[model samples]
Every structure is written in C-alpha cells, then in structure tokens.
Target chain A: MKGIIYGLVFFVSLFCSSFAVAIASKPIVVASTTQIADFARQVAGDRLIVKCVLAPGADPHTYQPTPDDVQMVLESDICLENGLHLEGKNWMSTLATDAGKPIITTTDGIKPLAISSEGEMVADPHAWFSPKNVAVYVNNIVKGFSQLDPDGKQNYEARATLFLQQLRVLDSWVRQQINRIPTQRRILVTTHDAFNYFCTEFKLNANNNFLSIAPVGWSTGAEVGGGMTPERRRKVVQSIKESGAPALFVETTINPKQIREIAKETGVKIGGELYSDSMGPEGSAGETYIGMMRENVLLMVNALK
Target chain B: MRFLLVVTIWVVIVGGLWGYIADRDTRRQQITAATPMDLSVEGRFVIEVTPTFSTEKDPFALTTSDSSVPPLTVKLNGMYIDTHTQEVLRGQTLRYEDVSGVLSGHNEIYVSASPPLSENTLEHGVRVKLYEDSTLVVDQTVWADQGALVSGTISFNHSADEEGSHDH
Candidate 1:
C-alpha cells in the first residue's frame, strides 16, 4: 500500500512538471496597449503568451514606462507597438530596443490618415478607430507571430482569418448603428482628435469637412501639434455653436476638465465618457476592441439621433 | 502486485492523455482545411443579383489597400462568382453565367453587399434569382437589418428533372 501511494505521488508530480514546462516554453508577446494585447491574444491564441504594458484606461499618449515595464520587455520574446507616435516619446520602441527584443509595429502597411499639426502633416496614430485599419493590425500581428514561431504559422493565420471576418461584421454593424443618427446631426465632439479615423470612416461632422472637432490636437502629450491650445479651443467652441451639436463627450483616458468647461460655457450636455486611447477595464462593456467600438457608436447614436 | 497496479495506472493515464491530444490535433486540422466542394458538378445556371437599394462602399469595410477588391462579393458553393467594385444601382441586375461547384442535390448561393450607410434606418434585401436555362429554379430575397450588410446564403435543391420545370 505504501509503495502504491509513493508511485502515484511520483506520477502526478511528473505530469505537473511536464505541464509547467510546456507552458514556460511558449514564447511571450508583450504589447504596448490593452487593445493591441487583445489583438495579439486573438491571433496567438494559446500558442503564445501575451502581456500588455499599459493597463486598461491607461493613456498611451502620456504613459511613463516604469522599471517593471522594462523588466517585462527584457523577459519577453517580442514586443508589439502601435507606431506613428501613439506611444508618447516612443516609449514602447525605446523599451524594446534597449532590451534587444524584436519589436513589431502593428500599424505597419496602413495608409495612415495625416493630420496637419503645427504646420506639419503628422500621421494619426489612431488607425485602430477604423476596423479596416484594424485588419492591417491583425495581419501584421499574424506575420509577426508566424515569423517568431514558424510552426504556429498555420494556427496564427487561421485565427487571424476568423478575427478578420469578425472585424468585417463589426464594421457593418457599426455603420448600421451610425445610420440611426441623421446625417445633418452627425457632429462628433470629443476630448481630443482621437476620433479622427472614426469620424473619417463614419462620415461624422460632414459639414465640418468630415473630420473630428476637439479642443486638443492629435496627441495628449506635449508634442509639436499636441496638447490643448487656445486657438483649438476657440475653434471647437465656434464649431459646436455653428453646427448645433446635440452633445459633447469626454474620454476615459484624458482629464475631462477641458471638455467639461467647454460644455458648461456652450450649454451642451456631456453625452458620455468614451473609451479612447485605452479600452474599458475588465468586465466592462468596452473591454474588448469590438465592444469599445460598439459602445462608442451606441452612445453617439443615442445622443445625436 | 503493488508495482503492477502502479504501472497499469500510469500507462492508462498517459495513454488517455495521448489519445486526447491526438484527437484534438485531428479536429484542429479538419477545421483548418474546409471540405472542398465538388466543382465538377455541372449545371447551366445563371445567377442574378438584384439589390433592393443601391450598393455603396461600407466606410468600415475590412478591405485591403488593393483597389480591385470589390465591395460586393457573390459566391456560389464557396466559389467566387462575381464581384462589383463600384456602386451597383438598384435596377441593374448583375448577372453571372459560369457558376461552378453547385451541387446537384442541394446548392447554395451567397451574397454580401454593403447597403448605403445613410439608409440604415430602413431594412434592405438582395434578390437572388437563379435560372437553369431560362427556367427560374430559385427565387429568394436575402434581407439584412436596417444598417447591416445584405449578406446571406440562398439554398435550393436542383434535380435533373427540374431543368425545364419551375418545380424547385
């Protein structure tokens, strides 16, 4: 009886150790944002372990990389970042480079929407706002994973194809939902110019050149054309008054003081807190990329329609 | 006796795990490669795609930078039949003659098109009319919700006897 008990214990320990080794052997993929992390997980599935540098609702524009983040990148096999300056001061790239880890820019191969900031045309880093651009992100991530783990290429590609189809469905759903709002009343006002891609894709603010209207420029950080400007504030106020926008909105990542003050002065109600730079926390409606877009569209339609 | 029992238990556990993993791998492979439809199944079929409303480019459509990829895609039995890159007017019935892979017993025609985003409040549909040598075989209208893509599969059974009769 004693020998049997010992043998059973040894067998269980061996199985447990083998399982742990299998899990540890899988490559780790560290992403810059929660949304990127979600996309990586969707493609990589259980083949690769995915980690996010920025927490949910954490602003990537002004996110300061911590020592823990550096250690995470150093231990990671690969790093993914939304290039075109979405990460403030190129923090994600800098971390990956310093750690000597291969980095994949998810937004690669996208025909970026350019924004005129401080007399210079800068590529808007909010390409994920449009699902079409997100297809590019998923494709790039698939390529990155396949290159790293050649054996998992077929697995990654299959998952990416399914995710791409889901994105197509999401795009069509968003359009149908946005169609609920009348064209003339489709004025989208938010904290920053984060929704420029969204507005361009959905034809919001058609009267205002089919672009987003906000008090802040593209980035929330103090880049050349970023941060809040007096002229930009005046323009936002003027546009809201001229267009008779039904409501204004604040972002979860940025401080709502500026937009709130504008709303108070202009007598426009704050429609809702939108998920911009980051997604909602775990268990929230805006937790996933599709969920965030759906919630944002629903909020906008309800307020404007 | 104790040694034999322990070895038997170990073999059973390990063998069960191996069987589970092998089964899982086989299932995954099956999902990865879709069952290829028989394109050799021949029929003189003409599929007509008639939109209830004008088809426009969906702003949020998942398309590559490739200019030639059409906004409207129609597939017959999992094979590409025709694609329209530009706006397909309401009255214009885009027709296709060479539709392959259609099974003789049961056939499927898939239609996916972007309805005008501006007309999202109103439900829209695409009328898929299939004619077997001028004899209408299948007439089905696939509808989408107010603002969604008009995408659905129209299935019908085709028999050799129904070639000239409008039975199916």
Candidate 2:
C-alpha cells in the first residue's frame, strides 16, 4: 500500500509540472467584463489564455471582484477593461489597481458621449455595444497586446484584421436594417448609458439618462443610480413625447418595470430588450460580442422600423 | 481524484460550447490587406487649399519680394463633382484666386454643387490646390479598403521648406 501511494504521488508531480509549463508558455489576458474579454479573446487567438473576471450571467455594472478574480488579475500580464466608467467606478478601478498589471481601456481614443444635457460632455464608455465602436476597441486591443508580446504581434494583427472586417460588415448590415425604420421613429430608449456608441454608430438618438452599462440610481436602492427622481422620469417622458419617438427600448441587464411604466404612460410600445451589459450565457444568440450586437440591431429594426 | 477534477475543468474550458469558442480561436485569418488611409494619428492636409499658381495677378495684388514674380495667383475651380463621374458644375463651381499654401488655415472649403449632399456617403471628399503654384492634389479619389483603412502618401506641394520654390 505504501509503495502504490508513492507511485501515485510521483506520477501526479510529473503531470503537474508539465501542465504548469504549458500554461506559463501562453500570454495571459484578464478582462474586466465579459464583453471586453470576449473581444480580447477574439483578437488574442491561441497565443492568449483569456480569463474573464465577470462570470457568465454576471452583471458587470454590479460586479465586485472576488479574491479569485484578484488572483487572476495578479497572475495576468495584461488586463483589458471597458473604461468610460462602465464597470461601476470604484469597484473595477480597485481591481485594476490591485492587480498591478498594465491595463488597456478599450475605449481610449474614441470620442465619447457625455451624459450631461449639453450633448458634448463626459466620456460614455459602453462603446463596445456598437459594432463600429468595437472596431476602434479592436485596434486599441491589438496595439496593447503587441506592446506586451511583440513576438505575437503578427498573430494579433491577423486576428484583429479578420474581426474588424466582420465589424464593418456588421455595421453596414445594421445601417441597412435601420434604414427600414423612418427617420422620425429612430429614437432609442434603454436602461443605462450603454447604447451611446450604438446610437452614434447606427445614427439613432439614444436616451439613456442612466447612461451606463452599469445601472446607477440617483441614490442607493433606486432602480438605477437611485435616479428614479420625479424630474428624471419627466425628462424621459418629455423626450419621448418631444421626439415623437413612437417606441422605447430596454436592456437585458436592467429590470423592465422602469421601462414598462414609462412605456405605458408615454403611450409608446416597448420595442424589445437589448443585450447591453453582458452577452448571453452560452447557447443564446448574444453569446459573442458580434452575435450580441447583431441580435440587438435585429431586434431594434423589428421594433422600431 | 484531484487530477480528474482538474481534467474535467480543462474539458469544460476546451469542450462543450466553450469548445466552439476555442475552435474559433484557431480559425484562420481571412481579412484582405487594406491600403492604409491617407489619414494618420497626426497627418497634415490643406483643409482650405489654395487655388493655383499663375502669372496673372489681381489689380490690387501687392508686390512683396520680387515684383516680376509672375504675380503668383491661384485660380482654383473647385466643385464637388459626382464621385463616380468627374463632371464640373456650371453654377455650383467654386472659384478661389492666387492663394498660397502657407496662408492656408483649417476651414471647410465647400463647393455648391448642383446636387447638395443632404445624406451620408461611405466616401466624402474635399479637393484642394495651391492657386499661385498651380499645384493640385485630388482627394475624392481616395477610398477606404476592406477595413475602412485609407493609405498612400498625401503630397502637399508646399512643405515648410518647399515654400517659395516650385518642385522645379
């Protein structure tokens, strides 16, 4: 019995070392949210060992990284996060700081939408929701990875090129679908500020006062940002009336009640819920970023146009 | 027993729906190489280009360095022509005279074409010229490749050093 146990231990030790060698050889990419992770993996290819901090079905807006998540970041050489305040401010930033890894905010050079009324204000970071915006994200990610692993630059660029083409095609297809809807009906209303990029890309006027993939309540315990103030609700109601927006939109991450009440009061029908914060679990259509955007656009066209 | 647990995770990560995703990681790149766009992070374009070089000077043409200097004037006939067919407009043609590339500042040089662009196009163009130098660079000819990337050297006749002297 003692001899058999020793043999088992020896074989396990040998297997563990071999596995460690294989894992260490690949570059590590730790992403803040599931969407960014999906985008990174699309570009990083086999050369990367991608790990998403937000679990499947986890809402990034409300995500608090666990010790395991911190460890994942600490072990990774690179981190990719959706900036624009999409990860609920302090929570995501703390993880980025603690991990002490070089982090790239995918929305870095793109012009951002400010939630402030002036129309030209703070950077809206949920740019990945728009396929065209994702094109920009793709470039930034490729540049960051190349900086980290010059040896895999060719692989990254090649992957980016292919993915970006799909984005361009997706953008064109979205435009075609949106064209089905008349200009007056192009108003898009969603739960958070998540769709700014989508609105900009597809040329729809998106009203997301909550204005973030991560919902904010004007106060704590509010549906979003505690922002369900009488004034904010009025603004949405007024915007819908003023824009003659025959329709309103919802997001997957947010509860539909806030939107339901507004839709009922405003006398507008709910178009459809969109995939905003996170993609679908696994088998659903919105599993991949591209797939998510495609599903959202298709739903939008069906609802509005 | 521990080995089996880890093996199952590896199986989950490398198999099932994730397997489809993992397979995508190995898919070959299929994007066609695009010519880089004429624009770069920091690139220069004569926003409001000069007209062209010419000996004919306006009546009020001020004489500076050398009066005999062909009264350098640029007579540019810039019209936003049909992108598909390059045809000048009779009324919509814009005319700028004896402009130097140096005095060129950033401005939207608009040409009132017969048909105003009320909608968007994948390709939008701005044509420019150095009037006094008779130097012209056509921009509408540019196109975005598969990745919407534009490429090629944007030649401006008047580099900071090439100011007074024509390429000649």
Candidate 3:
C-alpha cells in the first residue's frame, strides 16, 4: 500500500511538471515560410512564440499541408502568409481554413504587379524578397500581432519600429551593392519568379529564361512544367550571352545542373545561390529576411562587381 | 459495473465527436468572419523628413474612423513611408492600437473630424481621399530595408527624403 501511494505521488508530480511546462509556453505564431516567421518574430519580440511551416530550403510552391502543420495552425495565435497566390493555391487556404486562426495576408495592401512571361499574367508572390513589399508585410504582421495579442500591442509596435530601421539600412546596403555592378551589368537571373520585387525595387531587369519574373509555378524537380530539352537550354544560354550579364545565379531549392549548363555554355560563372521563395536554415547567413537580403546583396556585389 | 462501462464509452465517443464538430464550426466561423469585411481602406500621413526634436511618442494622429462594426478585428496597420528619418527613431517607441488601426484605414468614420481639405496637408490633419474599389491604407511601419509600396510607379520607399516627401 505504501509503494502504491509512493508511485501515485511520483506519477502526479511528473504529470504536474509536464502540465506546467506546456502551460508556461507562449502562444505560437506560425508563418508559411522562414522569411515571414523571421519578420513576425521581429515584430512579436519575446511575447510571441514564432515558427514557419516550410522548413529551410523547402519550396513554398509545393508546400503540402502536413497533419502536423494543420495542428500547429489550429493551436497558433496567427498564421502569416504571402497572399499573391504565393503558397500555390491549394495548401495555404486549406491550412488557413482548418486552423481557424487569422491568416494574415502580408501583401494585401500593396498594388502587386502582374509580371508576365508569355501571355498570361503570372502572379508574383515573392513580395517579401523586395524591401519595399516587405514594408507592407511588416505592417500587416504588426497589425496581426496587435489584434491577436492586444496586451502586447505596445511591445509589438516598439519592436516593429526598431526592425524597420534595420530594414532601411538593409535597403541602402542593397542599393549600394547594385551600384557596385556597372549599369551595363545590372542584370539579375535566378530560378522561378521569386526576385520580381527585388528587381523592380533595385532597377534590375528579370530577362532570364531560366528565371521568369512571373509565377510560372514550376519547381526545380520538374523542368519548369515540362522537361528542359537542349533547345530550351540554348535560349537561356543565348539570352545570357546577348544580355552580357556579369553573372548567372542558381536558387537554394533548385539543383544547379541547368544553370551550370547554361553558365558553361555561355562562359559565365554561376554566382553562388540566392534565397528564393524561402529563407536559409537556422544558424545560416540568409536565415532571417534582413539577413537574407544582406547575404543576397553581398553575393550580388561579389558576383557582378 | 456494466452501466458504468456503457456510460464511459458513451462519454468518450460523444465527447470525441463533439470536439471534432466544434473544431469544424470554429474554423468555418473564422473564415466567414474574414470573408464579409473585404472592404479596403487607405490612410496617409506625412512626418517631417528629419525631426531635430525628439518624437518620443509624438502623436502623429490621422483621425479616420471611430471604432465601429464589432471592431472588425483589425488585421494589420503598419506604416511604410519614404524618408531619411531612420536614424531619428532609434530607442523611441511607436505604439499603435485600435485607434491607430482606424486612423490608418477606415477614414470614412472620422472624415468629419479630419481637416477640411482633401489633399495631403499638415495643418489639415492628414487630408484623406477615398476610392470606391481602391483605397490607400499606410499605417504599418516598414524599414528602409523593406519599404516599397507597388502602385504604378509610386514607391513609398518609406524614406523621409525631401524629394520623396510629399506635403501632408
């Protein structure tokens, strides 16, 4: 009887401890991608428990809503999403709908550009890539946090103010980086339509076949919808040659084979990797939005200049 | 013992079903709530490009709407202006709440209190112009790092440069 009583007490203590930890945890704010989660964290400060559904290097285009993701949304206070049809069409709305949380579309306020490649007006979701669009995102995030946790509204606003300062520094740094590349060599080439806002903000043209300004909705796994044959590869090579871009770049998610082939064919070096559609892994250089932009500018300067 | 077993089973099954139903209902309600109030609003304000005087909690107010319509559960209201005031706001607080959200978006509610003129004016207390399909809502604060509003060619830049600074 004494042993039974001792066991009950021990179990109860363990249960109580577990419960205490869970209760002590802050409300989670989940974003669809790392770039957003980073921004949310900046605005939310210590008050919010923030995370992204798409892990580093994971493509946001094909991000399937996992059961765990749904559960996370269900439990989280807010879900930040890039709403220019950024999270593909299917997974995002479902997750937002399932979670019942206020899914904040960060790019809702701005007049988004309909960057076209062929005839169709391709949707560009890479607004966060550009500091300008990110301003809109930062605002939306602050608003979301304020609504969800009004008690910490003051803190959210204060932190957002500070983060904006850092972002301003980052923008000037990017402009400086672009200035490094001679005007003639100011051509940005990368995977997919991720850098449209970046190009628009920085005055660079998105004229690469491999990298379309519009959301063509192609993952690196497939050859941009269909297979990229030798002929299609020839066009990319020819464009790079005619444009005289100082460098051609590959994205973190895409395998570097196609871009490498284009570079080899065109005698241009592949200018490292760009954080398109997603941020870098935790502890990496391009992990946060500002860090990602800083790293991108640094890479662009080193490659083009 | 048999009755107790039946009761426990009934409770468990019924409770699980109820939980599922309740969760579904909750998500639907949230979506429905967001769906109706798709009305867009835009508010604009101009601050001194470089305020020598400290703006610690300076009331840069844009009197838009008084809180209305179940408060609409304000989504976001960050500001993205263009200027060189980045250095000015260091170590300062920029607190915005329900009043802040209304001031940024929803100008119709408080248009009466707003300055008489309908253009960007300082003494006019941030003149506002409304659009039926289109509106301008700039209450969110974005840094020079990521402050660009894409409307035709109007880049908010969120900078305080003299050229970028339009008369508010």
Candidate 4:
C-alpha cells in the first residue's frame, strides 16, 4: 500500500511537469478565422502553435465564441483577428481583452473597399478575396509573431518571403484564369457582398459598377451594415438580368436558399459554391487559402466561360 | 506495484511523442533553410523587355510604393533586374542594365507580367532579349494563354572569364 501511494504521487507530479514543459516550449496563437490561422501557420511554421476560434466553413460574421474558445484564448500568447468588424459584435476582440491577451488585426494595412449600407458606407472586411490584400495580412502576422518571439524572426521572415512569392504567383495565375471568361460575361453574382474584393480584383460584375452583385450586405449578421434586405435583393436580381450574368454563386458559409431564389428569378444557373466567409473543411480542395482561391477561380471560369 | 508500472508506461509514451515532435520540427526548419538564393555575380548585362500588350498596374498585384513600376517584372537569376520607371509600350523595347549577379556557364532570366484582363480573348506575349555589350546572348519570348499573366524563363550559355571578359 505504501509503495502504491508513493508511486501514484510521483507519476502525477511527472505528468504535470511534462504537460507544463510542453506548454512552455511553444507559445500559442489564437486566430479569429480559419484563413488567418492558415496564414499564421504558414509564417510561424513549427515555431508557434496556431488555433482558430472559428472552424472551417464557419461564418465569421455570425460566429459565437464557446467556452472552449475562451479557454484557448486564455492560454494563447497572442490573438489575431481580421478586424473591420469581421467578427460579429467584436467577439474575438472581447475574448482577447477579457483574457488579457494582445490581439493583432491582420488586415492592418489593407485599403479596404467601402460598401454602402442604408446611406452609410462601411469598410468591407473580406479583404482576403484579393491575394494582394492577403500579402498585407502576411506582413502584419510576421510583424506580430516576430514581436512575440524575436529569436525566430529570421525563420518567420524566410517563411513569409516564400509565402509572399507564392501569393504573387497565385495572383498572376488567377488573372490568367479570369481572362478565359469573355469580357462581357465576366459578371459575378454571389450570395453576399463578401466577393467585392475578388470581383474588383478580377474585373467582374461590370454592370453592377464593377462590384459584386449580391442580395445580402457585407455581413450576413445583423450588424448595422449587414444582413439581407428586400431592396438589396431586388437590385441583385435586376443587375443579373441586365448584365446577363452567366451564373450566380452561393457561399459555403451562407444559406444557399437566397442565391437559389435569385438565380431562379433571374433565369440563370448557379455557377457553384464559393468559399467566402470561411474556407472548406479538411480533405477538401478549398482547405488551404491558396487552394480555396484556386478552386473558386476554376469554378468561376468553368461556369462563366 | 501497479501504480509504478502505470507511471513507467506513461513516461515511455510521453517521451516518444516528444521525440517525434522534436524531430519533425527540426526537419521542417532544415528544409526551409536548404534553398538559398544564388547572389554570386558574374558580370554586367543588358535586358530588353518588349510587351505585346499595354502595361498597367494590376489591381491584384502586390503593391509597391513606386507608382512608375511597369506592369512587368524581369528577374535575372532570381533577382529583379528591371527597376527602371520608364513605361514599356506595346512592342516598344525598354532596356535596363542588369548589372550584377549573372552566373557564368548557364544563366536564366524569369519574366512575369499581367496582360490586360480585358483582352483575355487574345493570347499575349512579351519578348525578352539579353545582350552582353552589343551581342545578343539570349532571346526568348514568354507567352500566356488568353487572359493570363505572361510568365516564362529565358535560358542561355555564356563562356566568360571571372572578370566577365570574352578573350579569344
């Protein structure tokens, strides 16, 4: 009996010590969205452990933080978020503040496209749609991570350099792919305003003033400048009818019913689902950021061209 | 005795996991560091860029403060050699001095530029010519599918001294 008691105490202490060691060895970075988490992972590599508050295909505009997310934030050294109110009601910022963790806004230096909502213009938060904007995100993450772990600065920079080059390549490739669509047929109609950056980058939705045609506002949430409205829906349908948009696309994170209805009303086919607010789930082509963009472009070209 | 055995088993499992993770991390870092950029210089060379389409700032391209940067990027042996602010018109040859980092024996020039997406229906290309002093050492045209960015590599051989002299 005495031996068993001593051994049990020893084992418990050893286990706790090992757990502490593991936690201390690497710092944790909690990201608000899967895309930001993916970018952090690409730059940090194995130096930092990156965790996403929102799971794959989860809508950032409507994401509610769970108790687990709070716990994760509590343990994380830093938090990253796509600001401009991408997080509905600033949930990520609230969590980070409550947990006393520094929150880095990844979209720090991007020139956000403004969208009008109810006579007021709001900065669009879906900057990742343009690979150029994502480069800004990468740079911000590198700076944030380097501040946290100065020793790993060179490693982070090297990884970021490579990733930036890849982004340039992806940008070039996407331009090439978008060229396949006839100039007039380059119209893009999606479920929401999340594609304004993408359409503007690729020169789509010419009839809609070179922006995206969508029934929903920038955010699918009930934010001030968000959610679907009857006026917006009517405009989308009219724009599609006038532009002769080849097809309409639904987002994986949003309900397809709205887009389907619009497509039916406009007499156009659903091009395909796009990974907008979030990326696709694991084992899917849209798993990584690059993968998501590539698949979206391929689907657009195939449907429109 | 049972508790002692359980503790021993846990130790082995935890130790193995740590070892595996450490090894994996080291391997990843090594792989990242293995690819080093070749910055060794051979000599001065001139590169001419002639675009088949109008050059404009790609809204999707990586932003640079220099507004005069032409739509095209010409890299010599992985280094951006064209930094001139001059506008490269369609079929107009714009010359730049690629003054350093020309590797002897075999050299490569990478050219990438976005053709206007509006002209996606027409296939476009850019002709790149490399001249060492007046002799054209390498001439290659990089073409792109209708609506794609023009990206291709131009390779050539040059036999010169360490001082970049062609002594007969």
For model 3, how does the per-residue alpha-carbon lDDT over A61-93 read when each residue is reduced to its tens digit?
Answer: 766788888888888877888777778664766
CAPRI-style class, candidate 1: acceptable
Model 2, B1-168: lDDT tens digits are 665665555456445866787666656332334453332112232333221111122111111213322221122223222121233332222344433223222222232111111122343222343333343433332223222222122333333344444332
Classify candidate 3 by CAPRI docking class.
Answer: incorrect
Question: Mind giving the per-residue lDDT tens digits that candidate 1 earns over A1-305?
Answer: 88678778989899899999999999999999999999999999999999999999888988899999999999999999999999989999999999999999999988998887778999999999988899889888888888899998888877876787677678767887777898888999877778888999888988767777875323366542335578776776776666578999888987777667878888898999999999999999999999999899989999999
- C-alpha RMSD of each candidate structure in angstroms: 5.2, 16.3, 16.0, 7.8
The residue-by-residue lDDT of candidate 4 on A1-305, one tens digit each, is 66556666776898899898987889999999999999999999988999999998888887889999999999999999999989989999999999999999999988999998678999999999988899889878988988899999888878886787677668768888888899988988776778889988888877777797764333356542335578877776776676677788888987777668778987999999999989989899999999999999999999999
Measured against the true structure, the TM-scores of the candidates, in listed sequence, are: 0.76, 0.58, 0.60, 0.67
lDDT of 4 by residue, B1-168 (tens): 676676676678678989999999999999998986664645567878898988666544433233543577888878887754444677888788755767656778888776665675677899987777767767778888645567788876566654334321
Best by TM-score: 1
Q: Return the lDDT, model 3, position B49.
A: 21
lDDT of 2 by residue, A100-203 (tens): 77888888876777665234566666677666567667778888888899988888877776676566556656767778888766777665656666676667
Scored by lDDT, model 4 comes in at 0.80
Scored by lDDT, model 3 comes in at 0.59
Best by lDDT: 1
> What local lDDT score does residue B154 receive in model 1, on the 0 to 100 scale?
85
Predicted chain A of model 4: TM-score relative to the true chain A?
A: 0.88
The recovered share of true contacts, given per candidate in order, is 0.29, 0.04, 0.02, 0.10
Query: Which regions of candidate 4 deviate over 4 angstroms?
Result: A1-24, A216-219, A223-240, B1-168
Which candidate number has the best DockQ?
Answer: 1
